[model samples]
Target chain A: MTRRRLQILMPWAVTLGLFALWEAFCKISGIEVFILPAPSDAWAAGVEFWPQLLEHSLQTLFTTTAGFVLAVGFGVLLGLAIGSSTLVYKGLYPVLVGFNSIPKVALVPVLVIWFGIGTVPAIITAFVISFFPIAVNVATGLATIEPELTDVLRSLGASRREILAKIGLPRAMPYLFASLKIAITLSFVGSVISETVASNSGIGYLMLAASSNYNVPLVFAGLLVVAFLGVLMYALMALVEGRMTGWAFRGTDLMS
Target chain B: MSDPEFHPADFMKPADFMGPADFIKVDGVDMTFSRGEEEVHALRGLDLSIPKGRFVAVVGPSGCGKSTLMRLLTGLAKPSAGTVTLEGAALRGPAKGVGMAFQNASLLPWRSTLSNVMLPFEIVAPHKRRLRANRAEYEARARALLKTVGLEAFADNQPWELSGGMQQRANVARAIVHEPRLMMLDEPFGALDAFTREELWSVMQALWMERGFTAVLITHDLREAVYLADEVLVMSARPGRIVHRQEIDLPRPRTLEMTYEPPFQAHVHSLRDHIQTVREAH
Candidate 1:
């Protein structure tokens, strides 16, 4: 392997080694299954409940994906509209910050009451949690164009709409993608939390059921699924970002 | 053996060369800017008339309002008083015939060099309205312009991939790609190294000579001012106003060897002395 590739792989190797040691310690200590199940037990539980686990995992995935898509659509549009206009930014920035400040989890009870104890509340929760980052990042990106570029465009007799499309939107894409990566994770977290509190399906509900029944191995299984889902979602967003911003990476250290 | 009271009629001020009807005119313009409670006058009753196809350079020190003059000419800012006109029409906003470049190239990082140069056509029109219908033509134009700057090989490269000098070449290409009648270059080569700067200067001179577009170049480098400009206007500091106007008597198709000659050195020394005197006076 190349030196750089070896360096990146070393951390993953260490993490795996640590996990193996923990599994061995649990097995040797003869820990009670209910108190702290061994990694083997958790893996066994995951295998045994594979069908149900997959279904619950897909439920969480659907809600998070739906919420993330909506968040990106609305957030990017709102950001562009506000960012393009100095007056709109001045008038609406405070209101946006104020709305973002109200802890999104606090609205869960109201959402459940309104949309009921199902996918709707989870989706709403995901949207609420994920939208702000996309909006803030996109606005920042749109507003931060270099003065020289603007001058070049202005001198060329380019219209306002041209500046928006050619310079503004293309320039803002990197920021929007960075925000998407953050938003996707938040969307997953929001869906899980909403499901734990008031949902009848999904991995979060499965975790709650396992905990109440003293099924520690099953609980670990659910946690592992959630972690896996988060990574999967993040990877998807990252892939999209990489493809769109391929030009931005050409000479930078990030290209590797 | 001096010929006294013999002046060429064509040596009149820029204002007199224009017919009553012309393409662009800057008449009796004054610009003042306020910084908090303090008011600073930038241009004081400045009068300049550019005929349709002339390359004009304005050289001055840092605070002499050269940039302010460019901003005013491009209609980025309104004069505190007086008028800037294009084709006998008052300029309320940026005119449709002007293109600009600055000291820093400032190509957008997210765009490839080709896309960055193609940006003007995509944004402004006659081209903008027809870009969708004529995408291949516009792309061809962008490629051709990039080739002119020796960047056709690196068309897919982003701004950061290129060297500072290369980026500035792209900047110049981007400025003129839309075929603007009036090109405003605000110290576009200021950030480049000596060799690269000289190289790009030749590239710029060639572009201007071939295209035959009117140009307004703002620069602090006197040699650059002398080498490229048909006429150079020097301005005084602070409440800036044009103090000296020198007409270059050098032959066209100027080469770097001309810059090393006695006449060129004499012109450079005279401009330096004038600037020094203005500085000391201020």
Candidate 2:
């Protein structure tokens, strides 16, 4: 009981400790609110601008989710294509890696020129930044199929399509779910970067606007919301992942 | 001789009738795998014939192409030099009536034990066509097979929840679920503990006796070969060929106590001696 309780409480305790240290350091150093606001100032700003903050939060969520959905659908299909064939994997993998390495921030300007100063650029940026992990993880899952399992299927006279539907896709679930956990955060980063650079709305734009007005407390509040949403989405992914892939990582307590 | 364009299922025999080539035959088959710039011969002109419903074991030293032979027999790999035929027709792609198990159970983690056992029904024909229409019947069949392997209670259990021996039992259940004409087991019991291995030997013995599915087991253990097989084929090292064939004359439904008898030990010793000589010949 104690071990389980500790496992649950340790992360929360450390998080509280880190916040406490940061708050104490800013206050003790006699830093001005304009320079580095304490946690209390940020909290007050959050409560004061709750309605505005909530609206901006929803906007960011909408764009990020839209982009992420596109990434997933595109990633899985592309991953299946790349993983199933040696020729496709070799021919396109280098180009994909090269594209991923070129920062999505650079693509934001080009997208803005195409779509022109709106949520579309942010959504596109989010998708461009995050889709790589999903593709790579899924391809890895497909490519690393067990030789024994393949032999088992092949010797039974299973067709190529049957093998993919039955074995390849199911085996890729853990990888797919794992990639979501990583890609969701990147999507958020992509959205915020584009928003800050050239968007009319969202928490990123709000932060950029507030910083220009010297509302350091509001800026910190915006930062806090981004972190909260990132953590929330990650925790949500982890929960769904636990449910879907219980057989892979956790063996004992499984869904019936 | 190599026929690069052998057709699949071209054998002119009915699905269920006594034919001239009633059993699987590997005649003049050779396997050579390429490594970098050089070609490495694994099996050379291997010829063997297995009677229907017979239990056969192939035992040889490491790198003796035992696994290569299994791949060829199951149509996973083409023999470099010769042909493999079931009922006198050449095998091209994966054979229609074959099932295989390996040292590891290789069950899909996401599937329940029953689902894993019923996997082949979703792929192999006749069953594939009837799967959706006869879902409950297939489920019942899977449950019955699991019961045969003493895994009836674990039908809904995740594969990892089962013990190693139990997992192997599930593997055996899965292999036979499709009702293949021939079952290939490549070192299926090699990973189990001595007690578990012997226990599974009994389970397998009962299965074979009841169903009488033709079995071809590849193993390094001479004792296991002698205990389970009606005939044990010994092979030489790389570029291997069948060096000796020993027929087990001991009676049906073999018990573990038989391994302790003077005759059983004598058979094991003689086979071991031949395998050792074959290994040293390289």
List the lowest-lDDT window of 10 residues for candidate 1 chain B: B1-10
Clashes of 2: 0
- lDDT by residue for model 1 (B92-118), tens: 666664778999888887778998898
- Residue-wise C-alpha lDDT for candidate 1, range A104-173, written one tens digit per residue: 7788899987978989999999998999999888889888988767766766666667678878898888
Candidate 1 regions exceeding 4 Å error are A28-31, A252-256, B1-18, B21-23, B129-144, B155-157
Whole-model Cα lDDT of every candidate shown, in order:
0.84, 0.88
* CAPRI-style docking class of model 2 based on DockQ: medium
DockQ of each candidate, alpha-carbon based: 0.50, 0.74
Estimate, for each residue in B31-147, the C-alpha lDDT of model 2 and write its tens digit: 888999999999998988888899999999998889998888888888888777776667776776488999989999889999999999988888999999999999999998899
Task: Please give fnat for model 2.
Answer: 0.88
Can you give the lDDT of residue B189 in candidate 1? 96
TM-score of each candidate structure, all chains considered together: 0.91, 0.94
